[model samples]
Target: MKTYDAIVIGAGPGGYPCAIRLAQLKQKTLCIEKESPGGVCLNWGCIPSKALIGAAHLYHKAKDADSMGIRVGSVEVDPEKLQDWKEGIVKRLTGGVRGLLKGNGADLMMGSARITGPRQVEVTQADGTVETIEATKGIVIATGSNTIELPSFKFDGKQIIGAKEAVSLREIPKRLLVIGGGIIGLELGMVYQSFGSELTVVEALPDLLTGIDPECTKIVERRLLKRGATIHKNAKASGYERLADGSISVKIDQDGKQITANVDVVLVAIGMRPNSRELGLEQVGVKVDQRGFVPADKFCRTNVPSIYAVGDVSGVPMLAHKATKEGEIAAEVIAGHKAEKDWVAIPSAVFTDPEIATVGLSEAEAKEKGIEILVGKFPFSALGKAMAMNETEGFVKIIADKTTKQVLGVHMVGPEVSAMISEAALALEMAAFLEDVSLTVHPHPTLGEAFMEAAAHAMGSAIHILNR
Candidate 1:
């Protein structure tokens, strides 16, 4: 039997960070993982998909460089070579994650871990070896989530696939039928679309990219339409049939009308379900919600005092950064340090054709809550940097209290908004006012200027553009 101060399960973004922080706090810790160190976000979802998206963007740009007077003879995407490049990046990142865990003084073990008692865990190794480890301090669960697969459209890992398979495609399908219009679907769908797959997106919701600012969503929708992609909203994927010619006939029911779309591949990216079941959670008496999410307190503690849960298994807003933050908080609590999940806002980014990034509340959310809010808007088309880059298709919107001018939310869609939203997050976290941002000097000829300009526009003292 092996004993430690704490044992962290699932060495994903959340688990590894928790173990590292625990070790740094001078607590002997062990981190166990059944698969890769970086988990799904690094090995499959975020890193690999971003690599493909970058490749697709470059490929599309090279193919259409005639407008910029940079003509090319023939620009094509070699899928095999592209996959190799993506794999290399994944290999490096995963290796780095493992190195970080080891360097932080956390013992890394590759095995399947199960909680058998409040202070004991069972580890099953790959070579049919089982060992019992005792955690003297606490145990943290950060197992993350698994992709949701529809019962009617199970994955064959060939024609029918999930987001994991979608990112690792060696051959671009002639026509792609995406079942959901959420973040995962659109992000990966647009990647394939840019790679010359005729895209047909069928979202069950009334619109695409739900829960985001509708204005930002509309801009992305327009771009999707302009690029010759088909969209079907308020549509339900009833079923599908395999054709004789290596094609799939998808039946979508939209407003009681059955529309059939024939495509070479069907991607099911509805959403991810928390990987909460069958971990002996029931035997350990941890309260998992009906939706398979293990409920945890602000301190990341479960029903048991010695047990904690974090990351996707914890709750909604299951982002990688959010998971890492929770992991640190849990680690601190175990070390007798004062820590809690107290953050003003968490930002979300969508890697569509024109990226959408936002922090804090949306305008609709503020209005629905009956808060009197003032909005400031600045278009990328009006930005000098956007014009210089020739990528002006979205805007920056700042939401604030009409009376106090305290910043409430910031929403942006356009070039590199993912990197720009961090400033908004900092402003919100620091409780900065609209004037605090507007009065600050932003460097000229950069996308960041749009944030300052937007704040000024909200204050009704704009220099470049007219105030709304």
Candidate 2:
């Protein structure tokens, strides 16, 4: 009968951070994991997929070497080799996560944990052995989510696959059908499309990257089309059937028109739901929503005083950063410290051919909320770096309150905007004003200057482009 000051379930981004912070606070913290430490983000979701995306980007650059004054012969991509590289990165990161937990003095238990009582948990080890542990202080559940699948088009892990399998596909199918236009679908589609696969994306939303700026999407969609990828918006995947030759016939309903496409593989990236059920939450009187999410307060505390839930198991906007933030807040609360969760900006990044990054409220959201705002935009075409790199296909736009001059949102669709969004997120978190950003001198010949320029535009003090 082992006892600890606090117990953290799941070893994903959120859970591991919570456990480490708790242990650092000198609390006897125990972390239980059913699988690897890095969870989906490192193992299957963000890391590995980004590796593949990087490889794909390199391949695209290589294909365009002629325009770059380089005479390179035709090159072909080996999906298996790419998979090996992606796997190596995953292994390295996962090892780092494990070391971080162990170094922080957090006891790591490799098993599945389930709540049996308010302060008790049962663990099922790999060898079918069961053990019970008691937590004197509190418990945190951070188990992440899995890919959502339609009942009709179930994943077989071969032909029909989730984002996990799609990341490590052994072969790049000749023709790939991606069902869903969400982040996962486009990221993976870009990977395969670069590897010589005829790619088609079917999204149920009327516009790709729903709720994003239509102008930004126009640039990305144009680029995708030029790269030989077909996009079908306002489309729903009905069903699929296997052919005699092992190919799949995918049926899609696009704006009430039925169309069939044949492909070697189909990826379902619709969305993800919380992984909160069957954890014996009912035994401990933990309440879960109909969608299997454990409702939590701003500090990640559930209805029960001593119980907390973080990560995908909590609800929407199930981002790894969000989970980690919640984890830190919960750990501090459990350590008897006064802490609060306050985030004015949570940036969203889409790693398509031309990346899309946004922080704070979108223009549509601001308008819907009845907030009077001034929008400013600076196209990458006017950027020196974008012209030099020949990647001038997007813009950076900033939205600010007209009266207060407070920056409300920052959106970008261009090269490496993902890395540039940290400034926007930090600025919003610190309650930055339009004048604050506009007067902040940005370095010349950088993409970030676009943000400063947009800020200037928002204030009607634009040096470049006509004064509105």
Candidate 3:
């Protein structure tokens, strides 16, 4: 039996970073993976999807370059080449992850792992070789999540598919019907929509991107509608049928009214469920929640003190950055350092047409909690950079406490808001007041200036826009 100080299973955004940090903390860490090094986020989901989104965005820009006085003769899309380029990026990043793990002194093992005991793991390698490893200190369960498949519309991998296949399409579908108007669905649906697919979205909820700021979602929704895409809210995709001509007719139920949408592809991106089954967690006496997530405390420790869980397998806000942070905290805790899952906010970004990024409490959430608030908003149209880029579509919103003037949240929907959200997260983390950001001098004519201006607006002292 091989023995180590700590063992991390899954090797995902959560597990790899945990293993690396453990090794960096001078712990003998063994990291095990059943698939590619970077897991779904790198190999299938985030990185690949973002590559496609970028390509689609550039293609749209190039096609509409005539307005910019740059007349392009022809715009062509080579789907095969685009996929190859995206795969190249995935390969490079996964390779880097492997190199980083090895360089950080973490032993990487390619195998499927099962918890046999509180401190014991049984690993089965590709060649059918089995080995039992022992962890003296801790065992971290970072097995992320899998896309939830609706039984009504099974994944055929071609006509009907999940996010995995959605990102790897060889050719753009002429007509695409997307079920579930959440992040993954809209992001990919917009990519193909930009690629000339007639897009239709069916969302079960009353609104799109549920739990996000509705005002921010409205901007993206309006853009989709302007581009000839149809959106059905409070709707459910009841079933789908494949026709003789290789087209699919999807039946949608919205407000008790039946509607049919025929398309070349159907993407079911409702949500993801934690991958927690058959890990032998029960055998080790680790308690898993009813939703299949392993419950972990602030220190990322499970009911069994020797075991821990992080990332999607642990709880909600199933984001890669959140997983990485938890992984680092777990590693620190295992190294006898004082670290816990303590943060003011866990920021989120939706890579829609015009990205939506948010940090801390939303205006509705604050109101729901019975807290009086002051809200400030600045449109991207007011920003010179947005006008220069010809992408003036959304706005930046800042929410603060009415009494304390403390920055409660920052929500943005505009170009590059994904990258611009870090400053908002920092403000929330530092508990910055409205004046703290308002008084700071931001670079002139930048998109980020909107944040400063929004803060100033909250205090009724905005310069560019009239304070209401």
Model 3: clashing residue pairs?
none
**Candidate 3 Cα deviation (angstroms), residue 358:** 0.3
Q: Which stretches of candidate 2 lie over 4 Å from their true place?
A: none
Encode model 2's per-residue lDDT on 306-422: one tens digit a residue: 889998998878889888988998899999998767787678888998999988888899999999999998889888888988888899999999899998899999999999999
Better of 1 and 2 by lDDT: 1
In candidate 3, what are the lDDT values of residues 115-219, reduced to their tens digit?
Answer: 999999999999999999999999999999999999998998998899999999999999999999999999999999999999999999999999999999999
Model 1 pairs in collision: none
Q: Which stretches of candidate 1 lie over 4 Å from their true place?
A: none
lDDT top scorer = 3
Q: What is the C-alpha lDDT of each candidate?
A: 0.93, 0.90, 0.95
Candidate 3 CA-lDDT value: 0.95
Task: Return the TM-score for each candidate structure.
Answer: 0.99, 0.98, 0.99
Rate residue 28 of model 3 by lDDT: 100
